[model samples]
Target: MNTVLTLMLVAPLLSAALAFAVRRHDQLRDALTLAGLGTAAGASGVMFATVAADGPFVLRVGGWHPELGIVLVADRFAALVLPVALAIIFVVELFAIGQRKTAWGSNPELSGPMMGVLTAGVSLAMLTGDLFTLFVAFELILVSSYVLLTHQGQAAQLRAGMTYVVMNLLASTLFLFGLAYVYAATGTVNLALLTERIPELPDGVRLGIGAWFFVVFGTKAAVFPLFSWLPDSYPTAPTTITAVFAGLLTKIGIYAMIRFHTLMGMDQLGNTMLIIAGVTMIVGALGALAQSHVKRILSFHIISQIGYMLMGLGLFTAAGTAGAILFLVHHMPVKTVLFLVGGLIENDQGTGRLDRTGGLARRRPLIAALFAVPALSLAGLPPFSGFVAKFAVISAGIEARATPWVVLALVAGALTLLSMTKIWLGVFWGADPDRVSVRRPPGNRPMMLAATGIAVAGTLTISALAGPLFDLSVDAAEDLRDPEIYRTAVLR
Candidate 1:
């Protein structure tokens, strides 16, 4: 298990190094990127199998135990997210392979290396065990994402990437500062240790540190006030890059928030999360409604959807936490597919502006079908994964008797439906022949097929595996609610 986890982290970095060294060989570069991501995905599967059969697994570096050294911890929550992350990266990589000719053809060298590094960073972020290590992984992801966002070197891309860099660097600094405060007070950076010790700190210190951590992570997760950077930056990146970032990066921040809240003890800051969660939902949805571009609309909804995950965290019950976990797992893939399909639509039609596009459903029926599944699923339609995930969170809210939060969540769902349907009607279902066009050559069939396949598979995974996956999420929530299992495995 430890070997597999180590391989997962190293495979991409090693491939990245190889990619940089062999930059001129297009075939080799593409092969290395695919192979590296494939290996990481395989390693994720192995880690998942090991955890399913053997419970939790922890790997300590330098022969130092958890409290004394860096660790990589994998329990049910981490395990479940690992595969979803891998799947998103894998599909995006495949799409990149086909779209490279039209999309990244101008600067293959920059796009290739940056993407390898980005995939590696996501793998590391999901597996690192402590706050400091998580910070380092996040910075790695940020740097890689910056390069990807600005790969086109367009004026808009540069401006958006710069904003993204500035925002993330600030978040990284606050994260490091908060981690220093946490370590200075507790004398260790290990999450397992922090879980046991945070409760003993004075309320003033605890709340202060918790608040710093929340602001830092909230910024990264694009919550409420801190989310302005997201809409500006995300929609300008190359579609593939935008899709990957949309799917994984913010969720990594959300994952860290969940881990820290559980470890630091949620009781100390439940009310804070409760208030933030409500505001995030309302504000995010309203922002989504204001967007006219397809990517921008989806980007705004990302912030709103995050509120549901935060609501689960705020409730802090075992069930609420479980719902949050399930939502995170479900949301990442659904959002990724939506964004990728959006990219494909924009690529084929040459624009994502709602006013400029229409009648895609009649022109490209398959693409329309692919887009509808995740879009509707994201809007929380039943028999799809989104519905199941939202049901879990809303049910948990009800069970916890969080009436206001539940109402906010329900309203957010309705607004989400409105936002997605806005896209569907304006971009897909209309009949304005003058507003529709197709630029894809016959050779581009593979690209469309690849993107469509992924969207279909994502919808199927959620619908068919809902029962087992939700059960896994439940177990993960239990492990998180009681950190003894994690602590013992890591520290022993």
Candidate 2:
């Protein structure tokens, strides 16, 4: 368990250093990058399996106690989410390999190493037993993303990157304040300690802390009113970078929010979160409908779909938390796959603008098929993982009798379907543009397609295994709702 945990945290950073040392060798750099990501991903799978069979486990870095030093816990929640998150990064790395040297690919020299840093940070963020390390993990992710977004140094990218950085910087500042407040009030930043100490504070301070961190995490999750930067920032990155951001970054914020809020027993904030979740869902879906670019549309949907997960958390029930967990797992890959398909469209048509492309169904039936699966799933169509997740969430909401929030969720679902239909009609079904000319780097199609096909298969696997997956989600949620489970596992 300790070895697996070490590899899970160290492999990516180690590989990143090696890749940077040998940046001149393209194949070697890519191989090192994949090796690091693959190792961490494999470790995540092992961790997940181990935790499933044996329950939660913890690694005390440097043999220090949880109260005095770093701790990494592989509870059911962290273990369950880690594999899917790391796997998405691995597959995106493969796609990046194929997409390199193209107009759409990130800078080949830097993307690999930066992704290594990003992967390590993701592992740290998810596994950390304390809040301060989560902050450090966020910095790792944001710093790498900042470089990734602006490395190309195009005017649009710089502009978008600035907005992205500024917004996140504000969130980081608030995060620091929140951390200080937490430590000042609770006497320690260790989450397990906080779990016991936070709720003992006066009601006012406790609620204030909960609300403060919600805003901080909400911004990262791109929840409504804090989401304007996302649609602007994400579309400007290379498709591979965008896919990683789309799949993991904001979700990490949501992951943190779920962990922190629940463990601290902040049920007083549930009604407020539900209100925000409703507005976030409708606003995001409506925003998606208003976009003409594929990436931008998807970007809005990211915010919209986050609303569902937030809604689940807001319900503050075992069932609702389970639904939220399922939604998180389903959204990560499905969202990543959608962006990849967008990349394919951009590669083929030389643009993601709906106005600049059409008739992909006739010209490239495979791309159409690739886009259709995740698209329908995104729209919550039946027999897809999205449907299963949405149903769990909505069913939980109904049981909780949060009728207004439920109605907004359904409205958002309808808008999401409409947005997907708009993309299909504009990009795949209309007559081919008069001067349609395909643009792609030679010999890249097979690898890109294969990578995408693998992701699609993964999504199908999620759908097929939805039953068992939901069972695990519920078990994870049970642990989350009952904070003693986490505290015991970490402090033991």
Candidate 3:
């Protein structure tokens, strides 16, 4: 178990270093990067299975106690989410390999190494057993992402990267301060220990801490008013970078919110979270409806979908948390695949502006087919994983009698479907863009398509396995709702 956890964190960093070392050799760099990601993804799968069968596993770095040193835990929640998250990164890296040969790919010189850094950060963020360590993991991710976004040095990318970096910097500052506040109030930053010490604080102090981290994580999650940076920033990056950001980055923020709030028993703030969730839903959907560009529309939809996950967390029930977890799992690959298809559309027709694209359903039926499944899933249509996830969350809200929030969620779903329909009609059913004939370079289209196909297949697999996944989520949520389960496992 310890070896597996170590590989999940170390393999990526090692691969990243090696890839950077041999950056001049294209094939070798790509191979090393993929191998590292593959290793982490495989380790996460093993950890997930092992934890499910045995229970949570903890790794104490340098053989030190939790209070004084770093700790990593593969609890049910981490175990369940890690595999999906790592798998998405691995698939994106594969797509990146194929994409780098195309006009829309990220800079081949730096993208491979940077992606490795991002993968390591993600693994660390998910597994860290303490608040301070989580913050460190966030920096690792933010730094890699900053470089990824701006490495091309295009004017628009630089402008958007500034917004992305500044907002995240402010949030990171607040996060550090929150860590201090937590330590001052509780005398330690270890999550398991905080679980014991936090509830003992006064109600005002306790909720203050909860609300503080809420803003910190919520900014990262791009919820509500804090989300303007996401739609503006995401669409400016290369397609592969945007896909990873859309799929994993904001979701990490909500992941933290779920872990922190649930384990610390922040149920009192449920109403506040619910209100924010509703506003985020409507605002994001409206933003999507207003977009003319495919990437921007999809970017806005990321915010809209976040509202559902927040709604689930706000319900603060085992069912709701499970719903949120299931939603996170479903959203990652589905969102990534959608963005990859957007990339394909742009690469094929020269633009992602919906006004400039049409008739892809006839001209490139495969890309159209690839887009449809995830699009329907994103719209929460029946028999898809998104529908199952949305049902779980909305039903939890209904059971909790959170009537207004439930209504907002339903309205948001309708708007989401409408926005998706806009994409289909504008990009797939109308006249194709008019331009001079330019032959596409016989680049790595097959590899890109194959990578995308794998992701699309993964989303379908999620839909097929929804029943068992939800049951697993329920167990994870049970652990989350009862802090003692985590507290005991880590502190024992």
Candidate 4:
């Protein structure tokens, strides 16, 4: 188990180091990235199966016991999501390979190293245990993301990256402040221990600490009012980087929120999630509708979809929690592929705006098809992974008699369809007389093939494996709901 954990963390860092050393050799950098991501994905798959069958797996770093040192634990929830993260990295790296020259051409100094660091940061975030270590992982992700976001070295990228850095730095400060409070109150930073100990704190102190923690995590997760930074910052990064961030970074924040809610028990903060989830759905959808830029529109929808997950968390039932977990697994890969495809569109058309692009169906039928599958799936069409995941959450909502939230979710889904249709109609369908026509490059097919294959394969995987996957999600939710298993595994 320790070996697995070490491999997961070290592979990407080693790849990053190699990439830095071989920055001038584009082929070498690309090959190293592919190998690193492939290894991570393979390890994640094996670990997922291992945890699914044998229950939670724990590894204490440097052979230090869990209480005094860092512990890495994989339960059903972590196992399920970790593989999805790895898959996203794999797909995004493939897309990056296609766009490497364009991406690196923009900023030769930062692209390769930043990407490697970003990959390692995401893996570290997924694997860390205690709250303090989680904080360190979170900063690693933020700093790397800031660098990646500004990779272009353009004025807009710099400004957006700076805003992103400041907002997250402030969020990190709040998170640390909250952790200090929790540690002062409970005398421990171990998350599993905090789970058992948090309930014993005085109601007022618990509520205060919980609210502070929620604010910090909520900002990271882009919940409603705190989500302003996301739409602004995400679109300014290079498309492949944006795709990776869209798929993984925000999900990590949501992962933390769910973990904390389950471990600490949501009694004090459940209603807060309830209200925020509703607002996040409505507001996020409205934001998407208001955007005409493809990436910006997708960025807004990320927030809206996040609401679905929060709704599940707010329900506080086994079924609802399971739905949220399943949704997380489904959303990560699908969204990454969509964003990569969006990048392909931008690369070909020289823009991501719907108004300026048209006739893609006739000119680039493959890219058009790639765009359609995920777009429709994202709209929750039946027989697709999105539909299954959304159905689970909506059904859970109805079962819990949360009619208002169900209604909001339904409206949000409709708005999502509307927004997706707008993209299809403006970019893929109909003729545009205003835009200059461009010839398709021969190499475009392979890029489109890779992107489409990932999107389609992920959709099929979720649809075909829905039963067992749902079971895994439920098992994860159960582990999360009762932290004794995780605590015992990690602490012993």
Q: Candidates' TM-scores?
A: 0.97, 0.99, 0.99, 0.96
Query: In terms of TM-score, how similar is model 3 to the real structure?
Result: 0.99
Candidate 3 vs candidate 4, TM-score winner? 3
Tally clashing residue pairs in candidate 3: 0
Per-residue lDDT for 1-492 in model 4, tens only?
667767777787788788778878877877886777777777888888788788788887788876689888877788889878887777776766666555322343356566666666776777677989889888888888887887667998888888898889999999899888988999998888887788888899888877887788888889989999999999888777888889988888889888887777766577788789999998999999999999999999999999999999888888889999999888887788788778877777777888898888898888888888788778889888889899999999999898999999999999999999999888888896386644344244486467657766887788779888888888888888887877887776
lDDT of 2 by residue, 164-239 (tens): 9999999999999999999899889999999899888999999999999999999999998999999999999999
lDDT of 1 by residue, 112-190 (tens): 7777787778877777788788888898889988888886789998888888999999999888889889989999888
| Ten-residue region with minimum lDDT total, candidate 2 | 434-443
Candidate 4 at residue 295, lDDT?
Answer: 94
How many residue pairs clash (N, CA or C atoms closer than 3 angstroms) in each of the candidate models, in the order given? 0, 0, 0, 0
User: Residue 438 in model 4: shift from native, Å?
Assistant: 5.4
Query: What lDDT does model 2 reach?
Result: 0.94
List the RMSD of every prediction in angstroms: 1.6, 0.9, 0.9, 1.8
lDDT digits (tens) for residues 1-492 of candidate 3: 889999998999999999999999999999999999999999999999899999999999998999999999999999999899999999888888887877788887799999999999999999999999999999999999999999999999999999999999999999999998998999999999998899999999999999999999999999998998999999999999999999999999999999999999999999999999999999999999999999999999999999999999999888889999999999999999999999888888888888778899998899999999999999999888899999999999998899999999999999999999999999999886787233366258888899999999999999999999999999989988888889888888
CA lDDT, every prediction?
0.84, 0.94, 0.94, 0.82
